[model samples]
Target chain A: MAEIIGGYFTSHVPAIGGAIQRGDQQTPYWKPFFDGFPRVHEWLAKTQPDVAVVFSNDHGLNFFLDKMPTFAVGAAAEYQNEDEGWGLPLYKPFKGHPELSWHVIEQLVADEFDPVTCQEMLVDHAISIPMELAYPSVAEWPVRLVPIGINTVQHPLPSAKRCLALGRSVHKALASWPGAERVVVIGTGGLSHQLDGERAGFMNPEYDRFCLDHLASDPDALTRQSIHEMVRLAGTQGVEVLNWIAARGALGPAAREIHRNYHLPISNTAAATVLLEPACGVWALRRRSPRP
Target chain B: MPTPPRPGARPEPIPGTTLFDGDAARKGYHLNAMCYSFNRKENREAFLADEEAYCRRFHLTAEQRRAVAKRDVLGMIAAGGNIYYLAKLAGIFGLNVQDVGAMQTGRTVEAFRQFLLDQAKGA
Candidate 1:
C-alpha cells in the first residue's frame, strides 16, 4: 500500500513567482517571506516524497465562468503552466502520476465526491509558485503531481465543511491505493488578504493566527464556519484557506505541525507555509525533542 | 446601486467587498470574457491596438466601457467586474495589485504599499 508521508500548506501568491524569477529572494522586502521556505526545503530533502497531491484553486487560468467545477482533479501524465497575463515567467511542465490519479478518482466517485477529472489542464501560479518555493531552481520537479483544483473564483464555492470532506475522501482514496510510493499532500493559498472592491487591502492577521493555531490540532473547528462567514472573517480572497483546510483533511486525525511560517503583505496577501507529519512519525517526534 | 433590502431582511454589508455572485456573473459576463481574452499575448496586443474595437468585440455595456476607459477599478467593480479577471486587464497597463489597490482605495501607490506594510505591525 502507498504510504502517506505528510502534508504542506502554503500561500501561492503570484508575486512570489515574479520575485523568484528575478532572483530577489534576498531583497529586504522579500527576504522575510522567502526565509520561511528553507525549513520546508530541509524537510523535503530529508523525506523525499515520490508523489505530491496538491489542492489549489485556479485563478482564471484553466476554468473561467463558462464552465467551473466545484472540484476538479488532474489525471494527465503531465501538467503545463502558461501566461496568467501578468508576465510571470512560465515554469517547466510538471510530471504527473496517472495511475494514482485514476485510482484516487475512482475512489472519490465511489465515496461520492463527484469531482471533474481533467486529462489536459493548464496550471497557473497557484500551483507553480508553491512548487518553486518547495523545490527552488529545479529543472524538473522531484515528485510526480496530482493537481486537485477547487473552485475559488466562482461564487457558491464549495463550503469549508464540504472541502474538508472532499479532502477526507482523498485521504481514504490514497490510503486504499496499493502503490508503494510515498505521498505528500499539499494545500496552497491564504492566511488572509482581499483584493477586490473597497476592502482590497484587507488582512486579518489575528484570524489568520487563530486558523494556523487550530488547523493541525483542531481542523474541524476551522470548518464550522460557513462560506459567507469565512469570507467575512478571512476576506474575499482570503477564503483560499479552503485549500488549506482540505489539505489538512488529507492528513487524517493524527497529524502534528512539524514546521510553520507566517508573514504579512506578500503582494497584497498574507503569506504562510506549514508542514505536518503523522504525530507518531520520526520527524514529528524529533520536533518535540531537543536537538542533538 | 444595490437593490434595496426587503423589509426585515437586511444583510450586513462586507464593507467594500463585493461577492462575485450569480447576479454579478450575469452582469459582467462579456466584460469578464473580454478581460479573460487578455491571457493570450495576441489578444492583449489586439486590445492594445484598438481598445474600443476590443471592447466592442466583447459587447461591453456603456458603464463597463466607461469604467475601462477611465481605468476606474471601483467603477469596474460597480459594473460587476470580478477582481480576478479585472487583474488581467490591469496587467495590460503594467498595473500590479498594489497599483490597483491604491486606485480602488483612492490612495497613492506608495501609500498603498505603506498600508500593506502597516498590516505587519498590526499582525
Candidate 2:
C-alpha cells in the first residue's frame, strides 16, 4: 500500500515569490519570511517524497467565473504558471503526477468529496510560490506535483468542515493506493491577511499565531470556524485558512508538529510555514536513511 | 438531489459590500476577464494606450467601462469586479489594493492606513 508520509502548510503570498525574483531574500523586510524555508529544504532533502499533493486556491488563473469548480484537482502531466497581471515572473513548468492525481481524484469522488478533475490547468502564484520556497530549483520541481485547487475566490466556498472532510478523504485514498510511493500533502495560503476593502493590508498576528498553535494541537477548533467567522475576525481574504484546515485533516489527529514559522506584514499578508509528520507506524522509515 | 433553500430565501448581505458570489461572477465575467488581461505588460500598455478601445475589445458593459474610466473602486465592486482582478485595474493608476480599499470605504488613503493600523493593534 502507498504511504502518506506527512503534510506541510505555508503561505502563498506572491510578493515572497517577487522577493526571490529580485534576490531580496537577504534584505531586512524579507529575511524573516525567507528564513522560514531552510528547515523545509532540509526536510525535503532528507525525505525526498515522490509526490506532493498541493492544496491551493486559484486567484483567477485557470478557472474564472465562467465555470469555477469549488474543488478541482489537476491531472495534467505538466502545469505552467501564468502572469497574474501584476508582473510576477513565471517559473518553469511543474512536472505533474497524473496517475497519482487521477487515483486520488477517483478515490475522492468515491469517498464523496466530488472534486472537478482538470486535465489542463495553468496554476498561478498560489501554486508556484510555495514550490519555489520549498524546492528553489531551476531544473525541475523536486517532486511530482498534484495541484488541488479549492475555491477561495468566490463566496459560499466549501465550508471548513467540508475542506477537512476532503483532506480526510485524500488521506484515506493515499493510504489505500496500491503503490510503494511516499507522498507529502501541502496546503498553501493565509495566516490572516486581507487584500481588499477598508480592511486592506490587514494582518492579525494574534489570529495567525492562534491558528498555528491550534493547527499543531487542535485543528478541529479551527475546522469548526465558518467562512464568515474567519472573514469577520481574520479579514476577508483571510478565509484562505480553509486550505490549512484541509492540510491538517490530512495529517490526522495524531500528527506531530515538526516545525513552524510565522512572519507578519510580508507583502500585505501574514506568512506562515508548518510541517507535520503523521504518527502512523508506516512512516517510521522516514526517520531513518532513505530507502534505495 | 440537494435540498433546496426555503422559498423566497436570500442570504443576508454583508453590510456595505458586494459578496462576489457566482451571480456576481456571471455579471462581472467580461469585466474581470479584461482586468485579468492586464497581467501581461503589453496588455497593460494596450489598455493604457486606449482605454475605450480596450474595453470595447473585452466587451465590457457601459457600467464596467465607466467604472474603469472613472477609477471608481466601489462602483467596480458593485459591477461584479473581483478584488484580485480589480487590483490589476487599480495598478494601472499606480494604486495598490490598500488604495482601492480606501476608495471602497470612502475614506482617504491616510485614514484607511490608520484603520488598518487600529485593526492590527486591536487584534
Candidate 3:
C-alpha cells in the first residue's frame, strides 16, 4: 500500500516569479531570496519524489465567481497557465498525473472530502510560481503534479480545522493508493501579509516565527486560530496559512521537520518554507532497506 | 442606495470592512466582469482608447465609473469591487498591488514601501 512520504510548504508570490523572469536573481535586492531556494533544489535532487500534490490558491486565473470550488482537484493530463489580466511572461504548461489525480479524488470522496474534479484547468501564478521556484528546470518539471486549488480569495473559505481535516483525508487517500510510487504533498502560501484595504502591507514576523516554531511540534496551535484572529494578526491573504495546516496534517503528527526558512518583505508578504518527513519508517526508511 | 436584502438571506459586513458577500458580488458584477475583460490585451487597449465608452459599455454605475475615472482604489472598494478583479483595472494604469494598497491607505508609494520595511523591522 502507498503511504505519504513527506510534505513541503512555501509561499507562492508572483514577485519572485517576476524577479526570475527579469533575470534579477543575482541582483542585490533579490539575491538573498534567490539564495534560499538552492537548498530546496538540493532536497528535490536527493529525495526525487515521483509526484507532488500541490495545495495552492489561485489569484484570479481560472475559476472566476462563475463557479469557484472550495476544493478543486485537477485531473487533466496537461495544465496550462492563463494570462491573469496583465501578461506574466513566465506562464508555462505543467504536466499532470491524471491517474494519480483520479485515484486521489476517488479516495477523498470516499473519505467524504468531495473535491470538485477538473479535466481542464488553467493554473495561474499560484501553481506556476512555486513550480518554478522548487524545480526551475529548463525542460519539463522534474516531478509529475496533482494540483489541488484551495479557495482563499472568496469569503466562506474552509476553516483552519476543516483544512487540517482535509489534509488528513488526503493522506489517508494517498496511503490507500495501490501504487508504490513516492509522493510529496506541498502547501503553498502565506507567512503573514495582507494586500487589501487600509491595513495593507501588514507583516508580523513575530506571528510568523511563532507559527513556524510550532508547525512541527504543535500544528494544532496554529489550527486553533479563528479567521477573525487570522485577519487581525496575519492580514486577509494571510489566511492562506490554512494550506500549511492542511499540508502538515497530511504528514500526520509523527512528521519530523527537516528544513525551514523564513523571510519578509517578499512583495508585501512574509514568506516561509518547511520540509517534513514521516516518522513511521514506512516510506523513506523503507526505501533505504527492504522492510523486514 | 441600500440594496434590499435577498429573498431568504441578509448580507453581513465582514468585521473590519464591507464583506464581499453575495450582495457585494451582485452590486459589483458588471464592474468586476468589466475588470476581468482586461485580461485580454485588446480589451485593455480599448479601455485606454476611450475610458467613458468602455465604462458605459459595461454599464458601470455612476459611483463605480467615477471611482474608476479618478483611479480611487478605496472608492472602488466602497463601490463593492473585489480587489482581485479591481487589480486588473489597476494594471491598465501601471499600478501594482502595492501601489493600489498605498492609495487605499492614503499613503504615497514611497511612504507605504517604507512602512512595509519598518513593519518588517518592528515588534
Best by DockQ: 1
RMSD of 3: 4.1
Candidate 2: deviation at residue A53, Å?
Answer: 0.4
Candidate 2: docking tier: acceptable
| TM-score, cand. 1 vs. native | 0.94
Q: Just chain B of model 2: what TM-score?
A: 0.89
TM-score for the B chain of model 3: 0.84
Question: A1-292, model 3: which lDDT tens digit per residue?
Answer: 5656688888987788888878898887677667778888888788878888888887777887778799999999998887788876746688889998998788788878878999998888877887788887558776678888888877667778888888878777776677887888898889898777777787788888888888777788887866656766787788888888888877765677888877777778888878887776465454436547
Model 1 lDDT per residue over B1-123, tens place: 999875433257688888887778899998999988888999999999999999999999999999999999999888889899999999999999999999988899999999999999988
Query: Judged by lDDT against the true structure, how good is candidate 2?
Result: 0.80
Worst 10 residues of 1 chain A by lDDT: A281-290
Which tens-of-lDDT digit does each residue in A1-292 have in candidate 1? 6777889889998888888878999999999888999999999999899899999999888999999899999999999998887666688898999999999899889988889999999988888888889999887899999999999877888888898888988888887787889999999999798998878889999999989999888888998887778889999999999999999888766688989888898989999889998676464355436547
- Name the best candidate (by TM-score): 1
Candidate 2 regions exceeding 4 Å error are: A280-292, B1-17, B39-42, B98-123
Cα error of candidate 2 at position A168, Å: 0.7
Q: Interface RMSD, candidate 2?
A: 3.2
Tally clashes: model 3: 0
Question: Which prediction has more favorable lDDT, 1 or 3?
Answer: 1
